[model samples]
Target: MTDPGLQPERTHLAWRRTALTFTVVAILAARHAADHPAALVLIAVAWLAFCGTAYTRGRTTTRPLPHLTPVVTVCSVLALAVAAVLVR
Candidate 1:
């Protein structure tokens, strides 16, 4: 029998780290936008969505994950939120 590779495990861990980073950034953004309720909600929602997608992908995927759609969506939303806060 051959040894199973650790790539999948590493990939999952990488996604987990990305989710964590997103969460931290969201919190910081919330602090900076404390006067803006809508921006804070949007940041929190985007972070939660990313976490859900990451969890689903980790559970269902077998091969090296290569999807970027979720990441892009989260980033775009966050960028919008940042821009809104900046303009405030």
Candidate 2:
């Protein structure tokens, strides 16, 4: 008989990796925005940290796995960071 025990863990790891990727892009955006006021850059960094934390926490939830909220959040934050950098 086949088993289906490791799938959830794999899913969690995938999403966690996605979150980390967004966080990295956000960090780069923050660095690129260094010439502007510190507040924007700090906000970007903080948002990235929050995204990573949320994904890490989501990995522990039972059933249904994690929702798309974390992914959406990461995308939104990444977009905002880029926007902030470009607006300068």
Candidate 3:
């Protein structure tokens, strides 16, 4: 049997990291949008989609799904969104 404590610990740490990165992206996006108003809508839309997906994924009970799955997805989305917005 798997260690129960480890599972939750892994989940919590993974989520925490995800939340942190999300916050960072939000901040950066806000800053970029402030300087370039054109990016505002894109950033907002992308963020909303990302958060919605993350929430939906969290509600599922898929076995062996690493706690970092959603977190990584969110982080990657944020990174790409931010890069795209900044570049544009």
Candidate 4:
């Protein structure tokens, strides 16, 4: 069986990886919206919000994960997807 002590470390790493992924995607989306200033601003704001939640969760490893985190993440991704499709 896996060592229980390492589980929190692994979870923390996973959240960091997720935050990195969000950052990369947000950058790409912002680039895609370069021609539209409003869209760029919106994307930046969303990115900031997502990174905030991710890092917050990372720092509070002792607490149970917030129910809203996944919902927010999925919604952000969906918004990005829709924006991409509409842009194209």
Candidate 4 RMSD to the correct structure: 3.6
TM-score of 3: 0.52
lDDT of 2 at 32: 65
Per-prediction tally of clashes: 0, 0, 0, 0
TM-scores of all candidate predictions against the true structure: 0.70, 0.55, 0.52, 0.78
Provide the global lDDT of candidate 2 against the true structure: 0.63
| lDDT digits (tens) for residues 1-88 of candidate 3 | 4454556556655655665677688668677667665466656665665565555444443444566565756665775576565757
Stretch of 10 with least lDDT, candidate 1: 57-66
Q: Scored by Cα lDDT, where does model 4 land? A: 0.77
The candidate with the higher TM-score, 1 or 2, is 1
Tens-place lDDT per residue, model 4, 1-88, is 3345877787778888988998998888888888876667667767877888888777667786669788778777766776676566
Q: For each candidate, what is the lDDT?
A: 0.69, 0.63, 0.60, 0.77
Would you list the clashing residue pairs of candidate 2? none
The order by descending TM-score is 4, 1, 2, 3
Q: Which stretches of candidate 2 lie over 4 Å from their true place?
A: 1-4, 38-46, 49-57, 61-82, 85-88
**Residue 80 CA error for candidate 1 (Å)?**
4.8
Please list the residue runs of candidate 4 whose C-alpha ends up more than 4 Å from where it truly belongs after superposition: 1-4
True-vs-predicted CA distance for residue 9, candidate 1, Å: 0.3
Error at 54, model 2, angstroms: 4.4
